[model samples]
Target: MENDRGTKRSRWRDDDEERQTAERRRQEKERKRKQKQERKEKKQQQLDQNKPDDNGTSEPKETSADVNGLDLDINGLLQFKAPEIRSCRGVNNYEMLNHIEEGSYGVVYRGKNIDTDEIVALKKLKADKNQYGFPITSLREINTLMALQHPNIVNMKEIVVGGSLDQIYIVMEFVEHDLKSLMTDMREPFLQSEIKTLLHQLLSATVLMHENHVIHRDLKSSNLLMNNRGQIKIADFGLARFFSEPSQAMTQLVVTLWYRAPELLLGAKYYSTEIDLWSVGCIFAELITNKPLFEGRSEIDQISKIFDLLGYPDEQNWPGFKSLPHGKTINKPKNYVKTQSLRTKFPMMTSAGIDLLSSLLQLDPKRRMSASEALKHPYFKEDPRLQPPEMFPTFPSKAGQERRRRASPSAPVARHGDHLNDNKNENDDDDDDGFIMAAPEDEKFGLFREQDKKGGGFQLRF
Candidate 1:
């Protein structure tokens, strides 16, 4: 009877132990499931916060990443490294050569790839930090350049990062000289045929940008780069962006003062590709006359300068004239006295060229010539037609550059019916203020000198 009682007690103990083991396992499974659910929720929150709202449009949504405010951790974001720039510290990868140019964005240097023995332009971006880590300008430039591939657009080979975020380098295809530098170096003004070729290339590139839904906010002679083969590539896209939707608002403060459009000067909140067309018009005039079309000292003066040449925008000229942001406030009396005939100003231009210019500089943004339309203009299809890049005249090197510069006379002073006067100054390059966003001019009387040498007497700007 004692043996039977002991056996019952042993069986009860075994059942209790088994039950405890099952309970512990159930508790462990419940904890793991809860942890997994929490992790999934956290991941979804991150994705939702980062992704932009899809409003059912084909246009690339302006995300936080596109603008500023990206939390950039080089360590985490350094997942992408170009094979050419794999080695850091500038030793094994690239050998830094001469410093080329320094602009608002960064200092550009000529560099060589150690591995491939290729020359490249290394643009070191200025890492100015706001609440957002890096400047939106840099981000916009990087993203835009990466997406673009054109003969007339600067080619960005790859990116090189250093130990810190500040040491970022944009590897770009190296070109011999910028238009500004080349203009200064040239011994003669560009030939009529040469000008046509240059304009064709420029407009071609502009068409590519518009087709790709990009807008180059800053278009100036300084930003146009050219190689020895007469290939013109548009560079300096610090202010460029993918075209914004009509409903979205963008900053009006863009483009250099001399190249800024009338609508921007009037504080238009929403602008389109027409702004770039206006800039191209200004550049076109500059190339022909060897001087800026409208040189304004301030925002107000800039508007006045435009009116002085093109007449003020009234309801007749611009449909929603008074409705613009500062349209009514700053719309002073148009300087009808300074309004001269473009034909009279550019006596050398063909009728077709004049027509194209008028279309581009139309007061109504709606009427402004688009890149595509401009490319199709009769000017390009004229008798001489556009010449290939290879046919353009070659410029002499430094040995003869100074003589060429000295030989060309400053363009005659032609402001408000001024007489032709000879002004001789060799180092008479436009003030550095020409590069500034709000470039101011000291003189109201304007003169234009042809760029470079052989085309004529002292190329002059008054």
Candidate 2:
């Protein structure tokens, strides 16, 4: 009887243990399932917040990452390494008709994408093995141009890589002439009204570029180009790049020595958008005076030229001037005469213009105006020529991207205007700005590109 009782107790214990094991497993599964659900919700939230929005119906959406706030960690975002940017779009059958422009970078030839029945400019930049630095200037240009599409900026039609003898060919919109050419051929002196119009166009362009987190390190007369219709477009972004994070410190030289800001000229290691604004200021002075604002021959000559025009900047005026990389040991002019006067150069310019110019040409880069801030200044606010913001197109298509090109056979025929060619010829080697057209001087100026070309220049509002 005792043996039977013990056997019953043992059976009961075994059943209890089995039941406990089953309960533990059920609890564990429930916990795991809840945790997975929470994780999935979190992932979806992140994706929804970070993905770029395609908001504009009239245009395409922005790609890559927009770092307007610089909130994301840069290291985590550096996903794209050097890529083999090869395109399969062959150009063998395409016939090269006219040689467009040749420079230190490469040769540009106007050609028809026979397959697409579209006219395109083919830029061939072959990097020599000896040219150790900036071998991928073309690559940098592509990366910069990819994100921008303002009427003031150049547009890349397509990229042809690993084609035609291992060379890279960039097919871009074919513009007739550049601003430098147009200005040279105008023959008449630039009118004050024309200056305001040009400045408005340039300010609008730079503002868009800054919004996109790009610096056109080079901004000068040569870089601006024009089309047959006389619309202004900014071009040449070989040194341009997207700023995924806040601009960091660097010792690299940028911008042309002439338009280079006093800080860059002083060899300050770090820089930001201010550098571009300074160049804009110099270009503004150039347009008004019909001469370069600071014509520095060498690095030192350039610095001297700036001081001669602006003034001798001391640590008291420019607190950070002394610590700059190039500021330590420099040749000071025999007599340090500070000239903070713009009226002397442009007596006809308004007080508003003088104020904007001084702000942009400040010796301290930190004090330099921003592209955004500059846009709201009194110059643009008081601009007598500005129309509605909606009228301003973003890029090479001052004609409007939505505005279709005419379909007539005459539309296909390309004619190079003398005034446009003259503008382009002036800057055969402009380092700062590229071949861009002038801003519309009058409504009727664009009627005939050759005879009555636009009459505006980018005024310095930055």
Candidate 3:
């Protein structure tokens, strides 16, 4: 009984000691927290006392000295300051006038700046559910537009945001008409001088782009915008990117099917600015003929149409033709002729113009005419002097008043495995006896609207 009582007493004593130890630890923790609070209060008080008053008068705070023991004004010594970050304005600042058109990357709207009353094109970027964050194509378009600033290139005024995170809009200078719509509405084809003027402006913009090491992978008639003053502005930089020396392997699935280059159609992975020049060539032909130069439905048909116009490209013309990824897959047409029919196609075009066109549409990318070279071509210097922009006739802007009814095909969305397929019609490969003529007259021409005939056009004042 005595042993049990002694053991109980010892247990009690141990429990009492543990409680005392815990109590002491709690007290120490409380003391440290209180001390931290006091120090924070003291520092805050010192800062308050040192801070300048509303009148800009205060006791001079002690300045720390550098390693040389010389007092320095930190603000004066530090010449660099953080750049002020300005948030984008809300989209509500602009009143939505009408929906212009939806493109592959964004939905464009005709808007008016409420403050300045200036009309602007507001392009709200499309959200991709499959994407995790901002689309890379949209990001490239923004970055490219910001980097390139030229008169003939679309001007990005500012960026505006809507209510949500994905609701971003790009504010740009509003252009009156797109070339494709204008050509569709025209009663007759453009005059030679007018065509020359338009091509000159396009070449100028392309020169600027190429000089900056940028390649506009997509260049179609619908992508070119024209104002009332006849100024041309290249739009849609979703496929544009900076190219470096020793060309890199880029996607072959760029540029629309109608304007894709022959090499690209043949699956040339490492291409440069020549692909854009080929598209420009297609646009040039479209401007002359009042229709798309190569209106093929599929990749095979497109290449066949190209072959029908420019003849089959062999090792003599396009070196390393057999080495391309999809080059061997193309079966040469048995009945195909080996002669270019550009002269027969455009009989009315001057020899200089034909030469320029041929250079641009060369089967070999190495032989393709560059934008700078095309700008100085003799076609512009030939008879019928280039029509000045102001002299060019104005047209009714369907974009401002109403939505476009007959829009051209949107740019091809970037995807994989869209190359030439084996399931295409075998007849397209076998039947290549004659050149494919221009689109039928009725299909190419449209009745001129009353407003267009009356010379009534709209123009933004500011």
Each candidate's lDDT (Cα)? 0.75, 0.68, 0.83
Query: What are the per-residue Cα lDDT tens digits for candidate 2 across 265-288?
Result: 776756778888988888787766
> How well is each residue in 337-367 modelled by candidate 3, as lDDT tens digits?
6675989788777799899999999999999
| Candidate number achieving the greatest lDDT relative to the actual structure | 3
Q: How many residue pairs clash per model?
A: 17, 33, 0
The order by descending TM-score is 3, 1, 2
Model 1 C-alpha lDDT per residue in residues 115-162, reported as the tens digit of each score? 888988899999876554877888999899988889999998877887
Q: Considering TM-score, which of the candidate structures 1 and 3 is the better prediction for this target?
A: 3
Better of 1 and 2 by lDDT: 1
Clashing pairs in 3: none
User: TM-score of every model?
Assistant: 0.67, 0.64, 0.71
Point out the worst 10-residue segment of candidate 3 by lDDT: 453-462
